[model samples]
Target: MSLSRQTTSRRRFLQGTAAAGAAAFVAPAANRAFALQSPNERPVFATIGLRNQGWGITNKSFKFADFAALADVDSNVLGANVEKAAAKQKKKPDAYKDYREILDRKDIDAVMIATPDHWHTKISVEAMYAGKDVYCEKPLTLTIAEGKLIEKVVKETGRVFQVGTMQRTESGQRFLQAIALVKAGRIGTVKKVTCGIGGMVASPVIPVAEVPKEIDWDFWLGPAPKVDYRALPEMRQGYGGGVPLYSNCHYSFRNWHEYSGGKLTDWGAHHVDIACWALGASDTGPSKITPLEYSLPVEYKDGNPVVHDQYNTATSFKIRVDMPNDVEMIINSAGDNGILFEGTEGRFFVNRGKIVGAPVEALKENPLPEGAIEEVYGGPVSENHTANFIDAMKSRKQPISDVWSHNRMLEICHLSNIAMRLDRELKWDPAKREIVGDDQANSFLSREDRKGYEINM
Candidate 1:
């Protein structure tokens, strides 16, 4: 049962394929359970960013995949997670500071990416070309243009790609049921949806500090601007602890425009994705994104944040999106931290904890059609998001949370951030995937990667 017991024949098979510059063995669809049979049967995996969510997805996948390598710019994080993974799987994996080392290894069948928002596209696109399927965390890209590149690479390489929007598969299946309810017409004619993604708090000016010796600061800032490493003395608590709470690195990166798009892309990537899915707008996108009201933590000129030492993303925002079928979507940083679907027939409120209201309540008397949830999901839902990814790997098909749909929904989040940063409404040509007639706003679509760190392919 142990990986150390893997047969020599399997190693030679992988090595032979690698030497020939071909892909590793593809598991058949019958291996959907992912239960280990022989030692060589499990899919080989490597994780590129071993932070909070990075460790999270990998840790949950021990039963289904054999992790051969782990990579991260932070030595401290990489070493700790390697030990944790070894403890779970009983096979210590090789660790590296450079993610490219993982990509170069021909044996790694798939890579789980949990880098900051800016690094997702580069790592993902490269991984696909390197003959590895990718399961990247969302929001998948920092900009709409980055998303387009990912889509292009996925098409060019013909790789199985999964976006980490677990709500579509997990969260106790509440989100799945929510979508099922919409499809079943439990809430006839959805008129509007409100996604309250919570908010960020402005941080005090963080002073530049010494980069920890364990971390490679330059590598961590790959493709992003080279700036002085900044942090405060106070360490964060609870989730994403050990790093400075107000720093530009680590968990607080979500609060910076340089690395992330604030709550709009953070939680909006999750909630808005579900909202669009329910509205049958996953393939298409909004016609317009209007920042009705918002407040930012820093001043800006030409949509660029003036202050770099503090959190500059919006602290509170309410954006109105003109969705298809005249459905209005309100993404705000106020009210309950969940989604509210209002329709002519009934309304319901759903989140991680529960799905409630008249429509959900009436399911007892007038139930959804058999296989309704599965139908909404395209097939039987997996135990979790990773299970779905492994299943997709086996089937050599797209997972439930495919990249194209993720990018389409994620465009709303990115556009919301753009609208807020520039303080203007944006007319979107969804067919063209551009901001209409706004040169200044369109300029923010893609950022020039820092030299020497451009994407390899």
Candidate 2:
């Protein structure tokens, strides 16, 4: 045989041997199973933020998924959840302090983002880029600009996304009933809506506290301006840890503008969402926002708070918005914590617990058309919010609380915050998505994110 022909045959034999060796190295049961995973296999999930709402999703979502990983900046919380997941499912999952580590894994099929409001947009954008469906807790964005970033990424990556607004999937369907009634014209026309989300209470200047040993304080700060950790007891573990802290860190992060839009974003994320749906204004937003009256914990000038510390959001306030179709909305810090729809024909109040009023009352005699609530739910009733997300992932369809509509509802809340802070009425160009005329108000549409943590447009 010629020397050239013999050399070519030797090279082919070595290449085949190397390939066989590589296959042999991937023999671990986990790695082998991952390679053999079927396309129809139940999605394996990793959760990024796990405190109040994070744990709430954890408890309920286990049935529909194989919880393969958990990530948290808090070591104590991460370890506890890892143990809890093992006990609950008899399957111990991996744990990581940096969520990006979880995202880089090829085995994770989706992610649940329950981080503080400021972190949602960044994590979600990256998660979809990593080819994972996402279930992000609301309010879906910290600002209008973040919402735009998310919407763009969602379109670019056709991943199924669900906002953690479960009112649309409630068991008794009270919110659904209310929305159906309002949309069905039972109230004649939704002329105005009153959302009583209650007022914010400012925390006094919090003394700088020692950072918890278990937490990565810097990572916890994320995109927010650098500040000392104000140690807080994790709040509201039961009700998705509703407002975990009152002093403004950890669970109480909602009370500060640097992190959240106060109660405007907290409760408004839920109530305003339903109100938008009922009015058929989910895709658009209010044309104008007027702050009738409000008080901040500190002074303000030029659309920013005068005081840098303490709880900086509005302490108590009433904000009014004029949406399309000449419909009006009054958001209040007073009265029962629920949403009221008043139309020319009738009125009714509905909350998480029940739906009550003349419209709902008349339902006994003049019942809604059958399957009406289900239609509002996007098909059959989902077991819960997470279930709806999983179902959407399976069908390649949008979930009940989709990103576009949630952002629109959040735009109302964010605009309300802007007006309250500036202590005046502001007009909005919905198509342009800018605060009309007032350059300062328009500036509030997005925030100057901290370096390295910036969310790209």
Candidate 3:
């Protein structure tokens, strides 16, 4: 069957089974498959950040395990998601405003954290320290130093951390087949890779406004320098309040630097990660990043074009990355948003919906060896990515997107932003994890946190 049809069929099956009651149908099969020592074996899960991507992650992960709790800063969004998860699991789950409360629960086995970028490292490291496994969303960290710190905590605690770069699981026929061909030398000595990530334009500035009563703006701005809540419009919009407010929570946070890493990090977390994976550099990354050119938007905050004001990230740029082994890759937001692998023999391009090759029919039929890509997985053929996480939780095995590899890939995305911001070429020592020669660029590796809300690691 086609991929979409197969996915639809699986969803229908799940819906039917859920409607018939999980105890009467789903639990028996799962118990038999797992060979439970006791009749009441269910993995208890909790979710932090209950809206947007967090809701989907919770619902999906809970399908294979028991959801024990839901936590979020906003009660409106949190209560709705808690109700939905309760109905799905056929039981009420504990709810909390602070994620620390969920981590304190001894009964919870793991947590799925989908908070904003700034909160990822703080909550993820704390969860590991508290003896619970973590599944955090992509980009993994707001700063390069944060990624290293989280990596250290995971090692110290021996906790299983699955970064939510689910594309590793969903590449399907096109991307999988393409990667296999590249690895098998069908592409010959691969010398260069082209990764395309788009940019964001500048946003018109507005005056600061009042903070919402529902939001603990202080806690929301945790670990970041204290800016009046009015500086954040996107978070204000998320509370059902309209725009034009200074501190709105809504759709535009991805463009700002304080809350997100812009397109370079957003799409870079997805596409550049694939580049790192296909090149077999998941455990390491590029050693040199040079910002070739950038189109700066016209806006002023304090004499510097405020790329962080509303949307201060580069809107158009190209960067060249020098990896180990003489491999040079170019990342740009100028072309289509996908990856192009150019080798000595032939080239292959893969994107969200399509994969194309110089030899056209190679991707359609007569693809790579049947078992080559699956060999990388070494697991049962399952469509549910969240199920893979729960299984890993029980087995104590690394999930498909393990922390070490995902963090290494994320370094490339983070550094790319730093290079663009500094507008210079940087020599990086990957082994030492430091920027060589440039003290200013190195300073961008970590941010100044607010006094009372710093990440103590």
Q: Against the true structure, what is each candidate's TM-score? A: 0.93, 0.88, 0.85
User: What is the number of backbone collisions in each predicted candidate, taken in the order shown?
Assistant: 0, 3, 11
Angstrom error of the Cα, residue 448, model 3: value is: 3.3
How much lDDT does each candidate structure score?
A: 0.86, 0.79, 0.72
For candidate 3, write residues 179-271 as lDDT tens digits: 677788877988999998877666666456677666777777777667765454443444434433333243455665777777877888888
In the range 243-351, model 2's lDDT, one tens digit per residue, is: 3354556767887888889899989988998899988899988889999988888888987877765788888888889988988899999999999999999999998
Q: Higher-TM-score candidate among 1 and 3?
A: 1
At residue 25, what lDDT does model 2 achieve? Answer: 33
| Number of the top TM-score candidate | 1
Candidate maximizing lDDT: 1
Candidate 2 vs candidate 3, TM-score winner: 2
**Order of all candidates by TM-score, from best down to worst?**
1, 2, 3
Q: List the candidate 3 regions with Cα displacement exceeding 4 Å.
A: 1-39, 231-250, 298-309, 363-366
